[model samples]
Target: MTENATGGEVTFADMRLRPELLDVLSALGYEEPTPIQKEAIPPLTEGRDLLGQAATGTGKTAAFALPVLERLTPQGDGAGPVALVLVPTRELAIQVSEAFHRYGRILGARVLPMYGGAPFGRQLQAIKRGVDVVVATPGRALDHIGRGTLDLEGLRTVVLDEADEMLDMGFADDIEAILAATPATRQTVLFSATLPPRIDGIARRHLSDPVRIEMGHTAGEGRETTPLVEQSAYLVARAHKPAALGRLLDIEAPTAAIIFCRTRDEVDQLTETMNGRGHRAEALHGGMEQEQRDRVMSRLRAGTADLLIATDVAARGLDIEQLTHVVNYNVPSAPESYVHRIGRVGRAGREGVALTLVEPREHRMLKAIERVTRQRIPVERLPTVADLQARRMELTRAALEECLLQDDLESFHAVVESLTDEFDLMEVALAAVKLAHESSGATPDEEEIPEVAPRAVDKRRGPRESAHDGERYQRGPGGGMTRLFFSVGRSAGIRPQDLVGAIAGESSLSGRDIGAIEIADRFSLVEVPQAAADEVIAALRQATIKGRRPTVRRERDTRGRRPR
Candidate 1:
């Protein structure tokens, strides 16, 4: 580290990063190292174990990724990846893998992200072909190791990104098993948002003499709110979300935006619906092939598409320079995921907006997110019809001004003169504007987007409603879901996937739409859209589960709430 001419604050150029990485950094417009990067990079490059405490968007990925890439072996045939980064989710695995690929691109680094739901054959092929670094979720990495398809004998570094989250997702055993497989001398690194006991236990077990680095707002400073984005949410019922989102977009008029949905089904449906509403929208999800994902990204980057409707997993690690807005179609299940979603916007010191569409039922999740982030997410009313029309007129006025300033009007003056001879000049101008407004594809019907009535929060427990609170679990969001009780449970060797597959095979509903599955020794509760509840119940009765018919009934009935 070198001293700044004025003080001792060193820049990234002063750090001992490889020249190629520096070049990439410069090309990417990274002027200085973030605090975590400043402290963690040096030790990491020196081949030391690192335990870093940093939140998402604090540049933790690069803290570990770049050092691992720098330690890669010179290009040559190798048994397997030299570096392994275990992440909590498929989205993160893909994101970290891409980061390593980008930083190491100049050095011809080969990186692969291993995760579930993706085709096993494709992952296997990539593993067999050889790679320099493997960024994976613990479960998939272990699966490959068990099949003897992934070789870790050549490993030199092992890093755990979001260590706490990995533990939260119940991958502690998988992480331990994977760690045990790696060489004893391998350098280990662990990064987490908070160092809970479990994370500390893992660090003690694996990370030897690790350098620790923590990054975030200082304690006692106290947060007014997360200061990056102008965060707001709308209480729009599920049925009116599409219309509400359209109206919100009209008000926002963002250069580019990402509309986050919970599932591929929603992403596909929303993308299709948004396009129908005259927006240039695209769909991205794990269900699509890599080629399709690349195509969608190409369009987004080329400015042909302005809106990306994607699931959290598919949109992970995506950095769009023109991204001016991030919309949550539904409140995220976890607050950390919410942080990651909005982190995509309000970056690089630019003012950006984040809007979430919350149903009355999900008001609790909104509160939960606010509590976790130590800030209040201001809830806003849905835009009225008059508001939408005013915004449309404002946009029309701006467009006309731009045209007048830049476009040559000499060709149209004669036409204007002839029209002036027949009509008033103001009337001619109004006619031209009317034609422009009509041709601009703005919503013709300025109907108000319906708003969801605000759900009153219970003073003691917040906005969450439980079983006694109207059996709300039976009444899922959109008021179209029912929880069905099943007689067969663990004693009968029933699994969640088994219940999922059985219902999906017997009915029109896919497993993705299934929610809130609970399995017990003698019974199980499965939630499906109310419209399909009877159909699912009927189909399950006729179709044998585990080769036998199991009693299935709607939990809507009190007796059905108990095991048959």
Candidate 2:
């Protein structure tokens, strides 16, 4: 799970599952249970409450899903749902629901995925008809419960999948409400990638003497071990990021990759740019409808698209088997976020790569991520045009070698003989290789990316790092700082911590990146890095501040006037 291969090759059959389930596992080509599953299934099947911490692709779903199905009982015609799974987003809800369906189909289990954007009538009808399991997002699940259409009193088991993500999305209250409605004696299982204090509080309050399991990356004692992922970063100016990313992808030749951006606007723009550069890229964000998102996912899984350009929230809970690379368009604002994004690749013991594009000014935040993750992310130079050319030539050579191995050359022998008759044999072979390279679609590289070095941070000045040095209310992009205006202030119960948390949660900025804060009667002003100003504004626009849609933008110069 943590780029390390799962523990000893323990087969699913060794777990004593139902013969039918074992048969299905074999049919599906599943060889063994992952580390989480190996440790979790026995206790879960015994009906013990569990609190599991695992990364994204750790097979946690099966660890819980199989037990839920194994314990499933035959319900009466109008019985309430027996099991409930709460995920963070509609995409995850659908994905988890599909997994339950696939694994439980032979058992005649009824599963429903309830989320917003779908017709309420459909979900209502399905619930009334009765189901064995219901996979739902917290908000929509609470909505049904409030409407008196969903009954949780009969639930024998309740699962909080991706509990940390749900809490981050402000579903803590809804989760508490939903759990309160469930049977008090029911088995509770909480799975989170990271267990913060808040998650611990939930587990203590809800679970009854739960069994705890920690999987994925864990720092050792006073020593640094290499992560399973090949982590690296490139410090480049913002303008050259797109080109640099394209160059890196060409050199890596990833089987499939996901490029994470800060906002939907960024996802869209980069998706278009990557596609124009001839990469089969797809964009996924909260802005798209469920159907559109499903189509994009289908294409990627079917190998029609090799690159997925997505926002963080939209790509949650996705497990793509062929994914070999994860790219951070910008360094993550939160250190935990860096762990989550790269966890998508290098899973289940496969070698994978994690790439990041860091701007010169954001170097300090990158260091913060490294400190938190306890892994060194080497800042490597961008691949030059010459490097790209050499990679392309290598690819051409490999392709020709494969063709020679797999293709019959009898037909080409006649053409080769004809060409060699009029020219030297060596010259004819050179001409053929040139034609093969050209026909292989190796585009000529014309530009070299400018090199950039991270700005030196003066540790004596503390982490603020000249964040308040120049024009406190500068409107446009530059080096020092830019003032951002917010609509909510003291009246909305806004505080400086609230401002910092909002920006840090939504954008690729940490607490260290924010400078001074000025809260007025009707609005607030915060200084953020000029380099990340646009990204922060874009991310915040898509988010709510202090439970209100605050108008966020650059601070207008008002040197001589009193604040409104």
Q: Best candidate, lDDT-wise?
A: 2
Across 469-499, the per-residue lDDT of candidate 2 in tens digits comes to 2213222234488778898877786656566
For model 1, name the residue pairs that clash.
480-530
TM-score of each: 0.55, 0.52
lDDT of 2: 0.77
Q: Estimate, for each residue in 434-504, the C-alpha lDDT of model 1 and write its tens digit.
A: 98887777666767666555433332111222323122222124455667888877677665655655664
Every candidate's lDDT: 0.75, 0.77
**Shift in Å, residue 20, candidate 2:** 2.2
Clashing pairs in 2: none
